[model samples]
Target chain A: MTCATRIAFTLALATTALVAGTLAQSQPPARYGLGRPATGDEIRARDIDVMPDGRGLPPGRGTVAEGAAVYAARCASCHGKDGEGASAERLVGRNEGDSFAFATNPKLVRTVGSYWPYATTLFDYTQRAMPFQRPGTLVPNETYAVVAYLLFQNGIVKEDAVMDQATLPKVVMPAHGRFVVDDRKGGRAIK
Target chain B: MKSSRISRRRALAAGTAGIVGAALPASARQNPDTTKVQGPPGREVGARSPFEKPVRTAFSPARTATFTPLQDLDGIITPSDLHFERHHGGVPAVDPQQYSLLIHGMVERPTIFTLAELKRFPGRSMIRFIECSGNGGRAYRLTTPTAELTPQQTDGLTSTSEWTGVPLATLLREVGASPKARWLLAEGMDAAVMTRSVPIEMANDDALIAYGQNGEALRPEQGYPVRLMLPGVEGNASVKWLRRIEVADQPFMTREETSKYTDPLPDGTARMFSLVMDAKSLITEPSYPDKLEGHGWLEVRGLAWSGRGRITRVEVSTDGGKSWQNATLDEPVLPKCHTRFRLPWQWNGGEAVLMSRATDETGYVQPTTAELMKVRGPNTQYHFNNIRAWQVGADGVVRLAGGAA
Candidate 1:
């Protein structure tokens, strides 16, 4: 080994050592051995959140026809006779024709069809908190049917469409591409 | 301390007088001089003085919300009972003995911790403010355009408390959170089964899985037994009655984060995950319903806070926004916590307008409603932290003015 080659090798070793030391210091501390390991059944029972990409979706199927009956029996009293909204928020509206004019016009209402960015969110929300009085009462198929009815009323889906786990996620929302992540970083911008 | 001593002396004098007055007829007991006699013995639990009444104003639907009585409160730490509350489902009664928290998904070892086990971990106490993003929406949107408003009615959805809990970082390490995890779905055990997607950075930061508030077991309304406390984040994201957390690579896009909490923009795009609250201050005193008594010299008092960092300064304008003067910030102005501010004003029995603006550590000055409307438009549903204005008439009556009106 030449003298210059030996020097290069020594410098490389020092750099590697420095990097390794920093990585070790940055790693999380050792666990405190608290809390028991969760069983698979317990995890599955509580892990009910469904992501936008269809993860965590339960197996179920429902048609628009089935949804209409469920909507009248369960949702109409609060959401209105035709999902036009009464005591609760309006659930059906596609006004303004894709203009996204809600920001400029205060009178324009934000209904599920015109504002919601994902169909999966509709299902996720309905199954978790619906009927306003008795939330989490809707079975998987009822949740799917109610979602299909809402989407159909909003003019996003056809009356003949059958919504299941696969198709529910694939149903594109009108407001799908209208959301942007928050960009304000707390320095002088009011936004 | 001096004020408390004076009040005690006055009460003693009143009690002495009541002794002489207590010898009246039995029929006179309708307005009994109870101070003359021995008070009731201590019981298993205590209650507030019956004469001191400060109640929360609850809105409709029974599940909507209740506003704290900000005008009746003093100091930075809001009493646990008076803390503002917003619930999707009416507060659920959960048995702490049967409660457990599940942390799973994208972790080397999924774990479930009972309330007792969670308390066994090292504990940390912090003074932080939790605020509803829609706090001042009624005033900001001019929906309630009236000068007849109290501090509670105007902006009472924010409150501070000394929260004690185990750090979320400790729990994450216990579960061995995987490197691929970028978000966690926090789910509650309420009727609504409330859920929100919290960024992983917050878990690594100062997040807490709190079981205690103001040195007592959590109230059922405040998520008894357990709750996920993300300091400086919107209250909705800090899921209460916390039952489960699922670590994931991306946001869950829960209904709260998407259809509910998103802020609409003028550019036709609603902002998702707009979490951190901006600098805001409200002049609680010398506002509507608080009349000046002779008005030789009055001190204006209020609270200022920032989600990003400490409140660096609070500016007061006596004559609307035409001129400004720096107000004195009270001691222990902790970061991401409420900071009390005050300024002395001399009113010569004339009409004047009062306002306050807070500047945070990041040099972000609190904006007016007009300035915020210029950027985000008037329809942005949440995070309404704008300057408020109060007008004092020559008749010594104060009223809400300018900003919201």
Candidate 2:
């Protein structure tokens, strides 16, 4: 074969190989094909997490008045009659005028109002793990009501204010913007 | 002081005498010759020798934090049963056959993998350490500081194990995780339904959904059936008895992350997602409660680990922080795992202070207690990886520095 023809054939082969490699790279990964597709009902049953933006919150409405009753009946025993901390952590009270002195002052109490960055977390944690004895038993309405009661006691929301899927996420917490991402990067610096 | 020393010597003599006499049970004291009698047949399950008594201790009255006996352990792997446990909800007896993990949210195919199906994936095993961010806080914070503190009591929330499981990236890929997905929220099935939001970068990195630990099925206390193991991250973020994982574009701001795990800073701003454990080391031998019989050529041993990378060096300071010497690191010093360090010292029986500091591959040196406190403030809690000082008295008794003997 002529030298030019031989070079042309080699160039064609290399071009084909590059195209094949690109195609293979673009193709989707070969799945193990082991697990089955989850049903909608199954996903819904366990997808109970509520985001800061109220994404996973179920439709429910509750008022401070209703929450007070629920707290007395179900939560007051362990959480204290006034949420002043009994067997569990204190859920009430916020030092309104005091500066954020938790890092320096040992006397600062971290309650739901003072430290929690999101109000929706109250509903999420209460419904998922509260009453200490019986967890995941509270209905959505009860969870909302108890959250409202704690918020009210902590001087966050007004007594007549209602807490629901829409309003709970909108409740701006005092500690909302007080948090920063981790800055320590494991260097010579102590921090 | 002389009378006390004499009494100690008398007590030691009595202990030696009792070992061959009344201290032992009748069966043990009489059956000195094992070759004279036939041994019992092997059992279905095995147990540790009755004479060997290593136990875990609950640090709190609520039994929320069960600590591993660090002083009693050697090498790296913690016995599966004795691994440290911090359960928000109590251990749940999950049936392996019925257990399933649901991965849904921003995925091409939302799927459920049963325990049996998860085992079918190409498995990987790794030796890694999982440390609670709060480990060593008591000593570093100087709260309830005492010379009587053991290595276990000071820092026992960390444990190492050979975990066998599938990489979380593989599982996420199998589900066709979306390119835009930046976070995944892992939820546990315990009564607390413990949940934590993990960054997607970590998920696609060295994260493992572990099932087998130390060559056997995980104990219930260590999350039986299945659990997420984020290498080098805080233990709480691993999410034991993992039930669900939801891919998301933003963090869920779960209770654990927002209200509990976040570290409050001296500047009035709290730091969240402080997951990686810093490099730290402490001499386990010649620590509190371990009295030396005599001073001579003795080997000082301890463990050093880092979440960022392999422990590049461990420095031992026999003269309180004035001078430091590098300790020899044991072999198989894997990244994100415990590396044993040793040093030989000639003790002159004079009063001395002993301490160790670790430096990781990232060039991060474990800070001294004063340095750490200066940066983090006296009131901040968690991630206390400060250099620990052990004081050796003239009588050869070791204790925590600044602590009363």
Measured against the true structure, the TM-scores of the candidates, in listed sequence, are 0.89, 0.91
* Model 1 / residue A85 / CA error / Å: 0.5
Chain A TM-score from candidate 2: 0.83
Q: Each candidate's lDDT (Cα)?
A: 0.86, 0.86
Q: Candidate 2: which stretches are off by over 4 Å? A: A1-29, A96-98, B1-26, B143-146, B403-405
What's the C-alpha lDDT at position B158 in model 2?
A: 90
- Global CA lDDT computed for model 1: 0.86
Local lDDT at B100 for model 1: 97
True contacts kept of each: 0.85, 0.84
- Residue-wise lDDT of candidate 1 within A1-191, one digit each (tens)? 89999999999999999999999878746887888889889988887778888988899999898999999999999989998989888999886777676677788778898899999999999988888899888999998898988999999999999999899989999998999998989888778
CA shift at B79, candidate 1, in angstroms? Answer: 0.7
- lDDT digits (tens) for residues B20-70 of candidate 2: 245445666678898987766999999876555566788668888887777
Stretches > 4 Å off in candidate 1: A1-29, B1-44, B61-63, B143-146
